[model samples]
Target: MKKILFLILCFPWFGMAQGDGLSSTVDSLYREDQFYVGVTYNLLSNQPKSLSQNGFSLGFNLGFIRDMPINKRRNVSIGLGIGYATNSFNQNLLITKDGAGGYTYSILNDSQTFTKNKFSNQVVEVPLEFRWRTSTPTDYAFWRIYTGLRVGYVFHNTVKYSGNQGDIKLINVSDFNKFQYGLTLSVGYNTWNLHLNYNLNALFNDQANIDGIPIDMNTLKLGLMFFIL
Candidate 1:
């Protein structure tokens, strides 16, 4: 009877030991690729119809992502990452300070068509995604779709204008929004993917006025993304 009881007690421990060993083996076989870099072409949308998009706006991003497996299949994960991004806008905008110490925006006159005009911003962003991929441990090429949200804080901003008259550069311009949030989407196969972002917040604060009208603009970005495993 004592031997029988001993076996009963030892069986559960043996089963548990086997279960732990299998779990560890599965963990050793799991593959996680956690770094990616991307570049985007930014399109300024919702602008005051008066402001025209004159040239291509470019942006670049680099990030480190942590993937948390949510199921036994290891094909679905929650991804969290932090990254640095910068964007430049090429447009013709006339910004001037009024007597009341307020700033105003207007379209550049035909005679003053600037030789170069652009606004640029640098930001740090955090992104969270619900990711799905059809991948196996041995497969390096797979289809994936990642949808998420991103929040960013602008750390630097500047406007540059160069014309026949002269050159003007302003740093940390007033009325520029410091905080922004957006929706992010990435979908594709293998090393290259299609990425898109739609910003939900206005580009400028309510205090930014043009001809007594408040300026409200948003951004849209679309480009190719590359991943390294």
Candidate 2:
């Protein structure tokens, strides 16, 4: 029969369609993978009595998070990420290279004529977060709150001073604390989120001092965070 032959010929296509649908469903049920980027206003805190910030300080970071859902509906999960960040602080704490192959620290006066004085850090960072979201596997737009800890190692540093002292660039600041750790919180809707970081440790080691008083400055960042799948 022609009708029976037609049904037989179509069976393979029908099975193929069903197979594709099943595959898509499985992929949709277990996805929380995202890439994120952020820009921040960096602030220094716990400063020495004479040190003060002068200009704008900035920071940026980007990374990917591996999301693992723990609940059946997939709204709760944990994320671990590795990223890179460059943080800069513009302040009056001045650092100059001493002739003995070390560094000297001082607080600049308000009347000092300097075009720029700042220190920047290049860091390799890791973040671990506990995430709660109003998102389902199939939803693309939702609200989320992620709180976590971020730890980093400062691999490189630079200090620049120009003005009364002329142009001076100092690198490999030996007195800097190479290890940095902080608390992070990010919360918001679909595309825009507010992010904050409060660092718990000093920016420099105990050996970095001003007139025998240790410099115990820390950093706080406030900014926007964006995520993409």
Q: What is the TM-score of each candidate against the true structure?
A: 0.84, 0.86
Off by over 4 Å in 1: 1-31, 99-101
The residue-by-residue lDDT of candidate 1 on 1-229, one tens digit each, is 3653354345335434533444322343464546666778899887775688788788887677788878888899898988888898898776666679767788776788678888899999998988899977655568899999999999999988898658878889878899989999999887668899899999999998777777788899998766654
> Which pairs of residues collide in candidate 2?
none
Candidate 2 runs further than 4 Å off: 1-28
| C-alpha lDDT of all candidate models, in order | 0.79, 0.83
Error of 2 at 199 (Å): 1.1
True-structure lDDT of candidate 2 = 0.83
User: Residues 109-141, candidate 2, lDDT per residue (tens digit)?
Assistant: 978879999999999999999999998655656
The lowest-lDDT stretch of 10 consecutive residues in candidate 1 is 19-28
| Candidate 2 RMSD to the real structure | 13.2
